[model samples]
Target: MSEQALSRDRVIRTLPLTHWNQPHHDSGALASLEQGNVLFLPHLSFTLMPEELKLLDPALVAPKRKNITFDPQHNRVRGLARQQYAQQVTDLLSRYYQHCLQLIDALLPEYRHAVHSPSNTLRLHPVSTWRSKSSWRKDDSRLHVDAFPSRPIHGERILRIFNNINPHGENREWRVGEPFPVLAQRFMPHLSGYSPLSSWFQQRIGMTKSLRSRYDHMMLQLHDAMKADRKYQEQGPQVTLSLPPGSSWICFADQTPHAAMSGQFMLEQTFLLPVSAMLNPQNSPLAVLEKLMQQPLL
Candidate 1:
């Protein structure tokens, strides 16, 4: 086989990406994201006011939590000073979350309706200091798609918006890996069948917020399997991108395999998009896995 053919056989999937230095809601950008590519906007930014910059301190992170977060659903703030500065922090994050939603609506108008009732939050990672102490499954430095063991999503797409807020002009380093289909094929066969009994037990015991579906079970398995594989973590087909301060990017975290190598003082929002809302539903992880396994996942 030729070198290129050999590389393909080895499971390396590489594709060109257009970095948006200027905002565009055109079909091309939407098409690229549907294909599981990152919509990196080099100039798209959320500017923090002078006084708001004081929230950058790492000391604000709550004990035992990796980052500070504001959950709009409950109007609560976690991992930050909750006594004197709670309201201030909450207001800042809430505004930022709404700002992210506005960008999504403008950039991907097709998804505007699907963005409702999203479990969105604002998270500030003070530093990469938690890396060494994190467990394998919790480690963000390993290439893995987003999945939640405690929350059962039932195959909803995980769209995330990230902004690097480092005041020092540092770049958030990330290693994004192969397409969802390619990564799934490598790990799906190894995943055992899901059990209804186990799902019920976990939900009843409060181990999971809700009953885990077959789709959720498979996704968690795939997520853990990918993170635990040291060889794949080191040698997987991937590309590293440095997101400089002030820049923001958006992607379907569930469809894109990525690892945060290093960064600090970043804000992010997570939006859940139902599979039915997708322009090209077949490109979703749920759809791709269903076709490969020859069964309905959700």
Candidate 2:
């Protein structure tokens, strides 16, 4: 398809926030968390043809690894589907990126430069746990910002698009962790030892008296909080979005804390396509097309 033909705005403008529970704007919510402003688009359903699903089946997608776990704090079952879906996923994401860029261009024409970057892309984390259930634990998981220090804030946004390929009337919920910014701030001082600053300070001035004292105080508070709050340990914000086959949800990765639990029906599967830093100022369609026109596509 021609580049121009690919440029149609795809955002659902009527509902400012796609998901029911999301804040009207993510900036204010993120500020409450002591994080930078963020934009959240939810309940975004992408129309994927049956042929596409068939193309992504185990035979074509291939399995990369098995019994791999993602939770660092606790052990969870995980497996890599395979790199076979790499090219297919890239093509799909490229199209989705174009759709997103068109929407951005329409919404903030002046900030068009921001959308001119190649979308940072990665294949799905293969079906991590095919058919397994594990109890959630605090050491199992905790809330934190998605991006690291080095990554540019502009492209740091994450796209978590979920495609539910289940029969009609399947009851399922995506339990999101709570946004405890106050708790995060109170706990930050204690996490300092795990921070980059601690390493630098240790190298420069060995174990200083003041530093040790500060660390001790922070750890004590953190320990106390964990022990005191049973609800904080056992209870979390778990909401189920009953998505039938062909429906999807595209959400801001950092804004929402998420974990999944299987439904009553034993047979279940979900396709997740996560894209990071791909639609920023550098590698977007506008930028790439400009370069291609300068030196025609041979």
Estimate candidate 2's RMSD in Å.
15.5
Error of 1 at 37 (Å): 0.5
- lDDT tens per residue, model 2, 70-188: 32122222342544544454454444445444444443333346323233322222222432322222221332323322222322334333444343445334334433233344344
Task: State the displacement of the C-alpha of residue 172, model 2, in Å, after optimal TM-score superposition.
Answer: 6.2
Model 1 misses residue 197 by how many Å? 0.2
Looking at model 2, residue 237 earns an lDDT score of 32
For model 1, the superposed segments whose C-alpha errors exceed 4 Å read: 1-23, 119-127
* TM per prediction: 0.90, 0.44
Model 2 residue 232 CA deviation (Å) reads 2.9
- lDDT by residue for model 1 over 1-298, one digit each (tens)? 0122122212222223233223454787777787788877666677878888887776777778887766777788876754577887888888887787677666777887887544444345533677787898998888899998999999898988888878898899887788788889999877889999999999999999999999999999999999998988877787777889978878889888888988888888888888888888899898899989999976
Q: RMSD of each candidate?
A: 4.2, 15.5
- Superposed by TM-score, candidate 1 places the C-alpha of residue 281 at a distance from the truth, in angstroms, of 0.5
- The TM-score leader among the candidates is 1
